[model samples]
Target: MPHVLIVDDEPRMLELLKLYIQPYGYTCQLVDSAQQALDLCRQHVFDLILLDVMMPDMDGWTCCRLIREHSNIPILMVTARNQREDIIRTREVGANDYISKPIQEGELIGRMEVLLQQQYDGLSYDRESYRCSYLQQKISLTKTEFELLGVFLDSPRRVWTRDQLTTMLWGAEASVDERTIDSHIRHLREKLRVCGFPIEQHLETVRGIGYRWTHQ
Candidate 1:
């Protein structure tokens, strides 16, 4: 199940959002302040964050900026103000999207779904163009490397044995070897490293098993 962190100062608003979100199968952790939210983010992995713009202590904008410094988790800011400047400011602070207060169930859910589907931490990939980017910096990849990275991100933390990956990417009849798979992983890691992502920590070897993708 997808995990979400909901940050809002208003107790009623927090509860209402939980009620609106829980039935859709998202598990949530609620914090009443942006500082609490930032602290929790460092310790937990969340698929998305619902951040309230008007908090008494640290505002959502500051929290979002701090989170972006170390994480690529999707952030959707919720605010009463719908001015164009406010919307632009959300993006400036690295929020993926924003929503107005008096949140409508349909619109809120719809936006959440879109962000969840596109959640890839800091990495963005274009399958058609074979383009990959980490934190807005371009990372070049061969078609095979691109496909390999796609498989890993598609199922984070699912360890794939060499044979499983070979069959899935190539075919049962294809004669790709285990070493070839290792090479692809190495190249992918190096590319991400060059783009300044700590790929070593997020991508792990399963010792005698295989490999999996993990995140902070």
Candidate 2:
């Protein structure tokens, strides 16, 4: 079971998230403030984070940047703010992903999984703990990402649709949208590129249907 931290000021949101995630057999921790979240981060590591962006103090954007300074934990910023600028602002502050408020549960979980897969590098799960080569350094990925990526790495020629990837990874835990998958692919490819990995040759788009991995 994956451990996830959901930081929101709204009590109802926290309860709703708890209910949504409990059935998935995940350990869910709910915090109501940015300060509490930071404190929790210092205590233990979590698989992923679901953050609310409109807090009263130390808002999500600043918190996102601050957290990234100390850790690379994938963060999904939630907000009611709808402007593209708002999304971009959160992204610029180092959020792994962004979702507007009144969120669709399916979309949120879907995107969250994609973010996890992308951030964690989705490969090298054969070993108890494995490291992937990147820019002459080794970057460690979580078990989930490592396992997910292992599936893709082993079959470089296979194409995977959004539903396929989500179902394969999250099962009933979460269902992701096609666009969410695309975003993860895009983010993962960029990360790989930065680390000097041959990203483009590995991840190829299959047009309207979905994406494929093709080593050339």
Candidate 3:
């Protein structure tokens, strides 16, 4: 079973998360503060962390930063604050993903599964060189390209809308043109092609929808 650590200031919130998560076969450890979460991190190895932003003693952002200093464990920031700034800041502080409060158990579990699977498989990404592995060949990537590819590879065959891609690459507040996402995808596909990966076969457009990476 995958181990999960849930950090939240509210007891009810923690219990709710546990109730939802445990049924899905995850073993959960709960903590009420960021400091306690950090302490637990030092003592245990967890597959993922569900962290709340507005905790006492130390905020999730600080705790996230501190955790990243020593570990790359997948962290999903849970917050009632849905502002674009807050969402962007979660990424800045090294969270793998963020979800607003009134957590949807299905979406929460889906995100967790993605993060955990990516970590377990080491698919696409090479942390040491900041490169993406395709077949036996490895290609260097810009940070944006890397992140974009991560989104695709993390959920192969799932169509991601342009608006979703824009928000992902440039935070929700960013005013990025949809055309910009097209340009990035084009560039990313070209890089993969140059590296001998068959981009046309795998990276596909969905007419009015968006893009999907289909792993053959």
Give the per-residue lDDT digits (tens) of candidate 1, residues 138-178: 88888888888878877878999988889888989999889
RMSD of candidate 2 to the truth, in angstroms, is 13.5
How high is each candidate's TM-score?
Answer: 0.81, 0.59, 0.58
lDDT of 2 by residue, 120-147 (tens): 4322223434555442356555544554
Which residue runs does candidate 1 get wrong by more than 4 Å? 22-25, 42-45, 69-72, 102-110, 113-121, 126-129
Q: How much lDDT does candidate 3 score?
A: 0.84
How does model 2 score by TM-score?
A: 0.59
- Each prediction's total of clashing residue pairs, residues at least 3 apart in sequence or on different chains, is 0, 5, 0
Instruction: Please report, in order, the local distance difference test score of every candidate based on alpha carbons.
Output: 0.88, 0.72, 0.84
The model with the greatest lDDT is: 1
Candidate 2's C-alpha lDDT? 0.72
For candidate 2, list the clashing residue pairs, or say none: 110-176, 122-149, 123-149, 123-150, 156-213
Residue 74 of model 2 has an lDDT of 76
